[model samples]
Target: MNVSIIKYNAGNVQSVLFALERIGINAVVTDNIDKLQTADKVIFPGVGEASSAMKYLKEKKLDEVIINLKQPVLGICLGMQLMCRFSEEGETNCLGIFDNNVKLFSADLKNTKVPQIGWNTIYDLKTNLYKNIIENEYMYFVHSYFAEISENTIAKTNYGLEYSSSLQKNNFYATQFHPEKSSDAGQKILENFIKI
Candidate 1:
């Protein structure tokens, strides 16, 4: 399969590449529009600020490329955040593949961390992304902002409050948690994505 990881100024591309390699899939990391467009599966993973990343996508015209892809596309973390309609981070507009807004974790929530790092259970799983995964499976997460529960939400997780941990709309899929870093279950999720 021609698996390609979208290359940009974001962090964690190498980790995603390594994870795919571990699964026996040698994914190409590239910003080339043709490679991305023609890949059987595309992984859009990012670990960075929203405004800057959006700026980069606009400059490279990747935003349009990603939106127009017909094959399955997987977005992780900030990539998922960027897929939403808007983000509270930097008050930026996003790709709008999913009609939802990303918001910052409110500080008023007691005994909860800003960037809900580490393992957290994801339930209400729906869609092929969770094929062999069960409800309440722990997934690694590290983010200060989160996408709200909407019609597209496929899986839900709770930290300070309930939110959409995973979402699917047409050919696009996304996860707020870092499946590449989530151990066995994480690998399973990646494997499922590849199969899709």
Candidate 2:
């Protein structure tokens, strides 16, 4: 399959590439609309500012291309935030693929930390992406923003409060965590997506 990792100003592009390499899928990383739109699968993995990233996508008209894709598409971390209707990170409007709102984690999480970094266990598994992902499986995460639990949410995780860990709507799928760095469980999720 021709997997294209949408490249923009966001960070973590290389690690996504490496993750695909580990799975034996040589993916093309590009900002080109034609290449991205034509790819069998597209992964919008991000790790940076939402305002600037959305600007870049809009500037190149890649945002529309992403929303119109037919094949299975996945978003990781900031990628998931961009798929939402709006994000508090930069008070920005996103792709609106998923109707949930993204909000910043409170610094005062009782005993929890802001950004919700490190390993997190995901439960309430739904969709083919988690076909083999056992309930309560641990997935790596790193973010200050999170998606609100909603009808689109397929999985949930608890940090300070419970939040949507993974969401799905038709061909669209997103995760607030970084599966590329989540080791075996993460790989299984990616592998499930490939088959989907």
Question: Which predicted model would earn the best TM-score?
Answer: 1
TM-score per prediction, in order, is 0.99, 0.97
- All models: lDDT? 0.95, 0.91
* Candidate 1 wrong stretches, greater than 4 Å: none
Which 10 consecutive positions of candidate 1 have the poorest summed lDDT?
108-117
- Residue pairs with backbone overlap in model 2: none
Q: What value of lDDT does candidate 2 attain over all alpha carbons? A: 0.91
Candidate 2: Cα lDDT at 25: 98
TM-score of model number 2: 0.97
List of clashing residue pairs for candidate 1: none
- In candidate 2, what are the lDDT values of residues 1-196, reduced to their tens digit? 8999998889698888898899999999998888988898999999999999999999989889999998889999999999999999889999999999999989888787886779989999998899978999999999999999999999999988999999999999999888899999898888888888
What CA root-mean-square deviation does each model show from the true structure?
Answer: 0.6, 0.9
